[model samples]
Target: MRVAVLPCCLFSLAALAGCATGSKTSEVAQVRMVFPVQAPARPQCDAKPLERLALTGQVASQELIDQALHDSRAAHARVMRDDHVADASINPARLNLRVSVDNRIISSSCG
Candidate 1:
């Protein structure tokens, strides 16, 4: 019984050797823009300073994508889409807005 138990313990330890170590930090970033309602010709440069916004806690990627679509849809600026029209109300007025964003993962704390 002792001999059998010794082999089982050794096997378990070997199997878990890799699992005991921590993984390297991963770098990831994403950007999203949304327009729920009509936007001004030149929307005011109203970005909150980094300190004022919440970058941590609980947020999902899909939510951000949905927001980007919604915001782009609502912007009043002319976007270059094939279906776009300059209009008299008879034809639909397609939006012409451009949204670009960048993100980076820095090795910093949330203080």
Candidate 2:
């Protein structure tokens, strides 16, 4: 009877220890999978045109701007000074037009 009881006690303790260790490992793995690491920020000046439009260095016309805006599918469109264009927010669904004082399009970009 004593021998049998000793073996049973040892086996129970081992099973408990194994379960505790396994649960900890699984919890850590779950946390790592649920939380993702962030990537590096992209450059601000790397904007690209959403559609093919001959806008750069051209006279800014309402018709041309409207066409460009339509093609871009931007949620917001704004005509800003050429100098202020660099400071504009680059949004995937936004379009920015850098125009000179004479209403000529100096540059255009989309995110």
CA lDDT scores, all candidates in order: 0.34, 0.73
TM-score of 2: 0.46
Candidate 1 lDDT over 11-110, as tens digits, reads 9998677455422111111112232446556432121322233332323244542343344343222222223343333212222222222222111111
- lDDT tens readout by residue for model 2, 1-111: 999999999999999999999999999999989997789764332234533677877777888877777776565567788655355355775667879988888877776
Error of 2 at 101 (Å): 1.5
Instruction: Report how far residue 3 has shifted in candidate 1, in Å.
Output: 0.7
